[model samples]
Target: MFSLRLLLSLIMLVGIVLTVTFSSILSTRDAKHEVEELFDAQMVQTAKMLEQFYVDQLTEDQLAQLISQPILFHVDDSKIETFAEQANPNTLSYEHKLSFQLLSSTGQILAYSDSSGEQQLTTFNPGYDTRIIDRELWHVYSFFSEPHQVWIVTAQRDDVRQELVSLIISNTWRAPLIITPIMMFFMLVLTYYLFKPVKLLERHLDKRPAQDLSPINFTLPTELASTQKALNSYLLRISETMIRERRFSADAAHELKTPLAIIKLHSDGLSDVLSSQSPDVKQATLPYIEAIGEGVNRISHTVEQLLLLSRVDAIEALNKTDCKLQNIIENVINQLVHIIADYEWYIVVPKDMIINVDPFYIELVLKNIIENACKYSPTESLISIKVTQDDQQTMICVADQGCGMSDEEIALAKNRFYRVDENTSQGAGLGLSICQHIISLHHGELTFSRVQPHGLDVCIVLPRAQS
Candidate 1:
């Protein structure tokens, strides 16, 4: 995908090139027309000068000699030169392209330049005309001088006029051609710098943690402020909804605890009363009472988990104390002593390494993962918790010899209330979901994988606390 900066730069470049091209075309054409008009005026002026200066004063012999040889003098006598000498040494090798012919009113040639050869440049008409001589085209300007009773004609070769026009047009177009690319380069660079804020905003959003819904914190250009405001507003709405859900879960858990305890207490009392009866009465009544007790216990456990989920974020944020990794793991193992009774356990973590985190939340995550492993695995299965570190991050791996799950199950494990085995009703399937949220709050990741030879493995990665 092309960035906005590049797209805008291309647009401006195309527009500038087109505008320059169009302007050059129009200016060149106008310049060519002006040059042609000026050349024609000069031709008229030359004819008039010849008529006034030498036409009537020439004797027949002098006129005949002049016919064979053209006069070569600059209008300013101070700059006179022989016809054989060049007019401009700086110009391309000069050729005598200008020729003149003097004729009577009845079309009889009185005098003509040697350059004219044997050609009548045009009829004795009082205007401009194009004529061909020796297959070469010439532009001739003719006028009648009434006092001299003569027609004066001045002609220039068509090829020479064309060469002059081309030179003027090339010079006119040169500046824009040379300067346009430089302007386009700066325009592209300026456009990129001008849009720097937009690029910064994009990178900021892309790097943000998925669970971080905080408002953006940066000053923006006026044009982008509205976009930023809309994004913040949506984030605020999502935050409010999450807060409400957390509050509801906490309140419902608090409300259910009392009734669930009462139910357990009544079931235990009933079981005690039936134990004193005969074997036949005990057999049927005790099992029902035990089932009622188990149901109550399950409900109570679920309520406690819900309550922990509700307050995990706020609690973790408030508890920013440094604690040793070994101490936290020992506390979690103590809490799960009863559940892990049927499992073989191992821990490989340093006793001196410290982590900056909430002890309660960290222990809660460990408890949930360990409890999950025990619940799924067969009795006396091998379970291990290993911790290691690198320069930038801390890693914890929990492996269990449980029946492994499929790819689909591992993917959905982080979703709330999603269970790998739908037939098992022992848990509400919120254990891994809650663990994921807790890890994410601490800027960490929790991932599930299949252990080799029919087992499950989980890994937690967190950034190392700076000393």
Candidate 2:
């Protein structure tokens, strides 16, 4: 996945590094130029000083001796420390690299530093120039002295300026190298803080319940203000739509009940009248009357379930009371006794175990679960209602022994109108969905599991009533 935070951090890091690198390159180039200029100025000063002081003081015979034989400056390695001690301790070791030559106006070498050797540094150029002498590059500055009638050529090895420039550039880069990581760390921290509001909004949405359509109440940045406004508006529209849907379902179901009851009453009366007629007429008409009654009963069941589901959907909060688990289970079983009579029921519930829930809704939830068990299980099969409690919650499980549901069916058992075997059952399939909604309103859970050795287990978990 592409992370916005990572992308932003990478962009910022790359931008900062590029900026630093560009600055360093410019700084190094300028420093190299300034170093070269400073050294060139020193060479000019040395050449002028040599002409003004030493060459001008030379006698005619002394000048003639300089032209006779070239001088060389050689030092023994053993005496290098003593030489350094005699001179200034801070004197650079590359001082010998700086050499000067005195030439007569005719371009003949009149005198030279011992290190300059017999060769001229350059072609007696009167200004700054670069030349190679003895395979070593040098920066030479040649000056003409009218009174001395000579050329003062001062040259320094190119390596001297290069090494000095390298030292300066290296030092300059050290600071940025050390500070880059610290700057990156601060940048990451800054990015995190800058995007904190976005994360807050994401977490708010993630943790919110599906039924919760309330507007967001967070202080967001101006950048996200429009997004927040749009989100709240959408939620408002959804809430209004859901309210309208629930009202319609409840109203429709209520309207259907009276008509269905009238149809059932007439069908039952017709069935009774047919029973008193001749055997052939009674047999022929009774089945049709019973069929009509059955159809009415199924419609009534569906309408009642729809009404219950709509009511459960509308309840956002519960008026919870401490209700005895045993009493709730007994009431549910009594209501379903006619159908459950064929099944062997095993009830294991503590008489005093209580749950904090709305009594009416909890009873309805139990009735749906227990009735489903009775309907699905075969005659004489085992059905168990077990109540268990822990410190924080109470659990009630209803298990039935019959043909068990597959994993796919169990997964969608709580969805409305999703029957495991729709062909075999005459249900609207809203029973578990209603139970789920009621349990959710109580801050409880409803779950379905496939029981081993063939059956279904429906468990309800509600918070334990405080003592």
Candidate 3:
């Protein structure tokens, strides 16, 4: 999964790092250039000072002695520490890297610093130049003194400028290196807060009940205001559509009940009138009248089931009360006694078992389940009603010795109007669907399974009531 927060943070972090890196590179380059120019200026100034103050004032005899032997500034290794201590303590170590040479017009070295050695720093070119002296690279500045007719050369080792440049670059990089991670952390925190409204919207939708189409009432950022309004608009449309559908189902079923009752009454009256006719006429007409009555009854049953289904579909909450499970089961059995009389019932329910449920709906669910068992099973076949409870939940199971449904049929049993054997059963197939909806309103589960030796087991699980 790709996260928006991660993507935003990475883009911002990379942008910041690249900006800092580019800035540091440019700054290091500029600082290096300035340091080189300053050092070069110092070299030119030193060469001019040496010509104006020292060499130009030299006596003829002194010049003759310099041409005979050059004056060397080299110090003995044993006296180096004493010399260093005696010098200025604040002087930089790289000061020794700077060297100067005074050459005669004929190219004989008249005077030189110890670090410069006997060789010339550069050729007689009277300007800035670079050369390798004693295998060390140096930046050389040479000047010709017109009065003295000698060359004044000052040179500094390249490593001195390189070391200072390296120090400036390293110090420049150190700040960004330490601050980058801290910046990234803060960016991530900012991104999380910025996206918090999206997470809140998701949690609100996920926790809502299926039938809940209420508009979201959260105070979100202005950027998401349009999204919230669009979502609320869609939910309002859906809620209105469902309301129309439920009302239609209830109204259609209610409108059908009166006509079906009248038809049944007329059929019953016709059967009585046929009884007074001749034996031949009665035999011919009785079967047709009976068929008409059966059809009306089936349609009436379907209408009632449709009304109940609509009621279950529209229910968003349950009116719950603590009811005795045994009493509920007894009531369902008594209502179904006419159909269950032919079947052998084996019931196992604890006397003190209590459940928190809407009594009217739970009773309807049990009646449908037990009535289904009696309808499917053969006469004298065993039908079992078992109630079991654990710490967290209560389970009620109804098992019957009947030709059970196949796996494919059981998978789709709860769908509205889905029947395993439509020709054999006189049902509208809304019973299980209504039961499922009611149980779901109570936050419960309904499951169907095949029993051994050919039967179906229907079970419902409900959460245990809190103390």
Candidate 4:
């Protein structure tokens, strides 16, 4: 079975096919009709010429004399031969086939032109008039001046009519053959013209880069406005959903990392401590005990953070609060002293700067961003954190002069488990999502962009709470 779209196109093509076929059949029928008309007209003219031939040669009084002549079993060929010699060759050639017969109004056969038969009565009526004719049949209306009589003549063979009908049918089929290519060309062009937007949309989709989720920028005509609007709406929704999912994943990884590190540390310490103990004496080995404990703790930590991420992803994170931004940054920095200790880092925030936010949530946001920078940056690379007061908001930016990311990598940074290079950076993909949730909670905007020359730059804009 064909698809619905394909079926519709095929139906259109079929309509064209039927139209062409109908036209061809009609032309053939008309041609056959015309051929019949011509045959009847020629037959009438032949009868008239026979009338003229008799008028030119015989006097009015001699008509009865001719009629009174004895009927014979065969024609007198000698008279016809003399007649043919006296007439023009073309007239003889044309009139040679005109059969003649004498008939009474009572349908009695009197005589025939050839006098070849007397018993067989042929069909002749005085009632012939304009009417549809059968093939090879001719109607002749004639007058005998001497007897002052009229007669109708006809022939009954179907040769000429059948030949003409065949010719018409044959000739008519050619019309469709000639017309098909033209109709097909037009149909193809029309189909393409109608489908241009859909094809273009597909091409645009195919060419899109891996991380690009921007709005479609193709032109759709006014006729397709509703369709274009629908597609655009769908695209926007998908982009938003994908962005949200990516943020959630990154935050979950970052949130679980601290607990994961602690479990691993504890497990290692337990194994070292149990290694010297008697292995044969205790069936419940201390190493296995420690391993199970660490595994359970790690799983629990990962699950709990994932749940928190899920909640933050919900709509409740939009609720804003009043808090101090500068204090949040200070708290985040102090939490990461050991991680940033050996590296050269600069903080350019003013002492008195503050902004409205959920204080604890904002602190979590700062901690995630700062800790991510500390983890990804190479040794001796400078990490810069700045808070500048804008007219209506405070702009907090954390950037590092480490390995910069392309547009694709920068956009992917917030996705869970996404690291610039996973083998080099020890991270679970949860940091940026937590920061994003905190930003959302404070009604602040957090965006990631590539800094000039190298490295990733994250910007956080929080509207100032007026004093």
Candidate 5:
């Protein structure tokens, strides 16, 4: 199974990493650009300062001599000069890559650094340019001195600019990389803390007993409040359903007592009549015997239907198997042989058709539907049972050629204890309800229709199960 927390954490971590990486790249690029601009500014300032000082104080020949000589300026000595080499006492680094040159208006190089060799530093365009000198790239900035009719050019090696840029970009990445682990640890902790309510809800459910269906109420974050409410509502509905079942059981028990008492009374009366041994007494005993038998059968049928209803309610899953349609219908007919003895019944079904269903429940449903057809149907009338199978569904229909019911009666027939003809004593009005529920358990539907020319047709449609 996939984990929610792991997925969420991965998304958050990846988004953070991408954001940090993009920000670092932009910052490095901006910092390098700024550093290059500052270096160029420094070069421009040096050129301007030399032009102001040298143009009035020294002739062109004097400036030429100073640039050609290239004297090393010591660190302890405080003589500031343009592109001067300052020796370091602590570090013995000797190379200074900065150099200067002076040129006349006619493009003749009047003076240049000894380290510069014979390289021309600039294009004399009064701006910055890159040029290759002695097979090494150099960054040069030139300024034309209008008053002295000469140009002062300052040049620095490209390696120095590249080294500074690398240092800036490397430092830009080092700080975030060093602290990324700590940030990620905190992020994980925060994500876990946010999901604590869900864990608590799981543990709470785990601790509850299976029979408990009470509503749950907990103080939680806004994100989880709706989930808690939905769970509570489901529990409340289950509790309501349980209450209805309990009330139905009590009603059934109360209803069974009347028939049992009638049976006992009729049995005692019949026994007394049989003991008398008179012709009239024996004649009277026949009706009493019939009454007792009818009561017993009615009570037994009611009890069986009640028990079947309760079992259907309690069953959480159905053990469906391949059952022959003809076999189940034959079994139902055999079970109802006594009741249907007076009626002409017909079974119309294919020879070897099978359906996937719980055999016991299906049989019970068949018995109830067929028994109802026998009860409401007139004696010697035709009762037709048809089982048909197609690619989409399996249908079992029980139709009776008797006095059909009204629309109102058909609508109320499925309600427990609701009888179309209350005067009839054969059923407790639970047969159709039980049948409907059993079919529903298999994810099927039960429908009632009036047969043409005066009869009732009841059908059960079940979806075809995979082989």
Candidate 6:
């Protein structure tokens, strides 16, 4: 009934997801930065250990000879391989990959601490800033001191920084799993308090009496203020329309009762006068008395038609039965037999055209159409009634060779209280409206078309009966 609950829940759910995801990203970055800094500090200690060997004051030739040994014994040089292994200290953290390099001031690799083999060394350049080094390498060099000509480089290839960041992300996401249910539980509790007024309003509505015209009495919630205002507006409109309809029905009853009482009093006087009068006197009084009688009869008929129309409006559906479509057409034609005597009646029908509808309702629809045709048709004009059926639908059409209506007239024909000739005094202006309503009850379509050469054709379609 209210869209608030749906809209609120969606917004809260999205907010929870973004909060959890962004927090994980920030925590992972902090943990990675700290671990990378610790690894780089260990690289500085390894560079200090290499500088002690150079301080023993070995000749430049001897230092170059030791540095120039084959990086590994893969070239059949055991001397170079042994010295390479001895230069590497038995450190605590080097089981993964122990590597070091001796570099000229120009940054050429003179020796490697890895006896495994020489790795491609083309990536480094002399006098470049250390910022270009990656987190995975953890490098340190001796560029800060004088005689920057010789440099000792040391690094460990643990990949522990990336692994630490991955671990932080994995652990941080577990918070979201814990957070989701907690948020849902919090949302559930908050929503109960949030929509308290709506629930009270629902209970109030459920317990209301069928004809209750009272305004809803929900306590105003600050969160749902607009909702309460809208409900009040709708309630006021319903009350006003109900009052109007009650007055209309009461007026109709009072207006009809007065004329019926007057007609009865007049009829009684006429009956007494006729009984006591002689034959000659009776003949003179008969015409005036009969005129009064005819007036009463017309009024009674009009009142009955008006009441019947009221009943049709109040009904939601009519009784339905599958009966002969042709029979309904014949009833209308038969009632107008005298009027059509001078004119030809063309009736068409298929062998099978049964439709589901109330017989009385069908008769009412047919009577109104035929009478309208009779009044407008010229002398000796033909009227046609045809009933046709197909697998998908059934159609009933009636047409008259009369002075046909214009397009604008046809459009207004089905509206309530409308007539093609506003000045012509005749039946009440509600027949076509009732006919359209009845057809709608049967789930049918009613169409009016101007026939060629001065005529009007009205067709009604009903869904065909299933085989």
Best by TM-score: 2
- For candidate 4, the C-alpha RMSD (Å) to the true structure equals 14.2
Question: Residue 133 in model 6: shift from native, Å?
Answer: 10
Model 2 misplacement above 4 A: 71-91, 105-116, 131-136, 144-149
RMSD each, Å: 5.0, 3.4, 4.6, 14.2, 13.6, 11.2
Collision pairs in model 2: 73-114
The whole-model lDDT of each prediction reads 0.80, 0.83, 0.89, 0.63, 0.79, 0.68
What's the CA error at residue 345 for candidate 3, in Å?
Answer: 5.0
For model 6, the stretches where C-alpha displacement exceeds 4 angstroms are 1-28, 31-35, 48-151, 155-254, 257-304, 314-322, 341-344, 351-353, 376-381, 401-412, 424-426, 449-455, 463-467
Among these predictions, the greatest lDDT belongs to 3
Listed per model in order, the count of residue pairs whose N, CA or C atoms clash below 3 Å is 0, 1, 0, 14, 0, 0
In model 5, what lDDT does residue 213 have?
71
Give the least accurate 10-residue stretch of model 2, judged by summed lDDT.
75-84
* lDDT tens readout by residue for model 4, 90-113: 444223233454444444444454
Name every residue pair that clashes in candidate 1: none
Q: Each model's TM-score, in the order given?
A: 0.81, 0.89, 0.82, 0.46, 0.51, 0.52
TM-score of 6: 0.52
lDDT over C-alpha atoms for residue 101 of model 5: 79
Q: What local lDDT does model 3 show for residue 467? A: 58
Residue pairs of candidate 3 with colliding backbone atoms: none
Off by over 4 Å in 5: 1-11, 52-57, 60-95, 108-110, 253-467
Model 4: per-residue Cα lDDT at residue 265: 78
